[model samples]
Target: MHRRRELVGWATVGVVLCALAIPWFLWGSSTVVFGLPLWLWWHVGWMVLASAVFWLFARRAWGLGVETADSSERASATASVGDGGGSR
Candidate 1:
């Protein structure tokens, strides 16, 4: 779970960096792809790529079923440890 969360974080950073940086790099391009300017196509491509990355992150890291199980285990462990009821 921790590794999956880390992967999701890295993927999110990648998507954000690509969205912000790629267009700036292509700011003066006059090339065309599929009838759009190259810079415009670059933005569109990143949008699609970001969507896929987010979907993968969601599927792997956001599943409620696993979280519930982990939470329940933690709750049981905490209950077994109990508060010390200090300083009587």
Candidate 2:
């Protein structure tokens, strides 16, 4: 399940990256916003989208391939530390 979710998340990131790379849709557009061309605006919006996707990835799946101790293990370790690591 973890592997599947990771694959899907990364796939979404790849799609967003590809969209940012190509601005074919705006090639014929002459629209202007604020002072910039449509394509420039497209880039800005795409960059914001990419940042959001990356933020989600960082929040949810940033620990790819890294080993982490289980919660139970952590609890036991904390208990051991609280006992000074010596027999009473």
Cα TM-score per model:
0.52, 0.57
- Tens-place lDDT digits, model 2, residues 45-71: 888888887898789666543534344
lDDT per residue for candidate 1 within 1-88, as digits (tens), equals 5434565677677667666746887767899887888888777777887788778767756543345545644554677653332211
* 35: Cα error in model 2, Å: 1.1
Per-residue error for 13 in candidate 1, Å, reads: 2.5
Each candidate's lDDT (Cα)? 0.64, 0.67
Model 2: residues >4 Å from true position, as ranges?
65-88
Candidate 2 lDDT score at position 6:
69
Model 1's lDDT to the true fold? 0.64
Positional deviation of 76 in candidate 2, in angstroms?
A: 16
Report the number of backbone clashes for model 1: 0
Q: Which ten residues in a row have the lowest lDDT in candidate 1?
A: 79-88
Pairs that collide, model 2: none
Give the candidate number with the greatest lDDT. 2
> lDDT of model 1 at residue 23?
84
